[model samples]
Target: MHIVITGAGRGIGRTLADRYRAQGHSVTGTARDGSAEIILDVTKPDQQRAMASQLRDTAVDLLICNAGVYLDKSESIVGYPTEMWAQTFASNVTGVFLTVQALLPNLRKAKGKIAILSSQMASHTRAPGGSYIYRSSKAAVLNLGRNLSTDLRHDGIAVGIYHPGWVQTDMGGPAAEITVDQAVDGLMARFKDLSLENTGCFDTFDGQAHAY
Candidate 1:
């Protein structure tokens, strides 16, 4: 598979890139630091278009929208800085939208799949309090996946919103239950099984579907 992963400079995204490469797949990664195959800021349309230009003639089998940020340190919504909340949404939500939108043509050529990196906290059915900024952003991504799936169904593209679980990465912190390798491995397993029939579903790394 020719896969494109975002936020690949570090953490789960980096680990996923490595894993895919190890599996002998062609992988392209994007990050703000310019450390991957492409330097892309998901919030910027110019950057996304530039990245698309770089892959213009190529068809990507998979696009993983994995770039995100957390504001767990903030105490409460009332105490949260509105600017910070907007920034978080820009990276986590809007970034995913722009990146996927920019890459749709390439993906359509391949009848590809899009895997969005969401969070367990996004589940309204299993709602957990706190981390309001992070939680809400992920929830928004879940909806994006749903709407995108509906809109793209006739295009033969599959979309999945996934929770990698509490991975032991910078975002998940050191005490997280799963290692980045394990998390990525599980997601890969799930990715292999994704199909248009299940597009718009929310899933965890372990292959179980989540309540949206």
Candidate 2:
């Protein structure tokens, strides 16, 4: 299968890209700084267009919208700046939408699947307070994925939102619960099981259904 992953320079996305490649799947990993196979800043429309145009003749079997930011992780309720919220949403919410829109044609051509890397923090049930910008952006993308799933049903495209767990990556921190390898393995399984019948499902990397 031909897989396209955004923000694959590190963390879960990087691991997924490497694993897929090792499995003999064609993988195009994109990074914001041209550090990976493709140079795509998910927040940029022109870059997205360029990517779509470059891959015009290729069929994408899977498109993983994994590029995102947690800009407000350090913000407190008293000091949450407006710019932080806007920047976070641009990459985490709008970026996901733009990627889907830009690659819809490729997805339609191959009847592909889209795996959106949302977070359990997005769930109303999992609210533990703080990180307002990250939480809200993730919640927004979850909504976007669900609606996109319904809208693209007839096109044979499946969309799923997932939480990759509290992985021990740069973003996830040293004290996080899961390792990158564990998260990647579970996520790969989840992606393989994704289908039109299960589209728009929000679940953990380990396969448990998560409450929205």
Candidate 3:
């Protein structure tokens, strides 16, 4: 399968890229620093268009919208500036949508699957008292993925939203619960299980259905 992953320079995205490549699949990893196979800042329209055109002739078996940010992690109720919210929404919410829109054609060509790396924080049931920007952005993306599933159903495209767990990465911090390897393994399994029949499902890395 030909897999394309955004934000693959580090953390879960990087691990996923390595794991897929080790399994003998064709993987296209994109990073903003031009360090991966493709240089793409998901929030940039020009870069998104360039990526789509570059892969215009290729069929994408899986498109993982993994690029995101958690800008308000340490911000208090009074600390969340308007710019922070805008930046977070651009990276986490709008970025995911743009990637999906840009790759719609490639996905259609292969009847591919889209795995959106949302968070348990996105769920109303898991709501906490912090990270307002991150939480709202994730919730927005969850909504985006669900609606995309409905809109793209006839095209044979499946979209699944997932909470990848509290992974020990630069974003998740070293004290987080899961290791990168563990998260990657579980996420890969979840991705493989995605299908049209179960499109728009919000699930955890370990395969449990998460409350939307």
* Per-residue lDDT of candidate 3, residues 1-212 (tens digit): 99999999999999999999999999999999987999999999999999999998799999999999887888888799999999999999999999998998899999999999999999988776798889999999999999999999999999999999999999999999999999999999999999999999999999999998
C-alpha lDDT of residue 208 in model 1: 89
Residue 33 accuracy (lDDT) in model 1: 90
Candidate 3 clashing pairs, residues 3+ apart or interchain = none
True-structure lDDT of candidate 3: 0.94
> What lDDT score goes with residue 44 in model 2?
90
What does the lDDT come to for candidate 2? 0.94
**Candidate 3 root-mean-square deviation in Å:** 0.7
Candidate 1, residue 210: the lDDT equals 84
lDDT of 3 at 42: 94
Worst 10 residues of 3 by lDDT: 124-133
Q: Rank the candidates by lDDT, best first.
A: 3, 2, 1
lDDT of 2 by residue, 63-169 (tens): 99999988777877898799998889999999999999999999999999999999999998887899988999999999999999999999999999999999999
Number of the top candidate by lDDT? 3
Stretches off by above 4 angstroms in model 3 are none
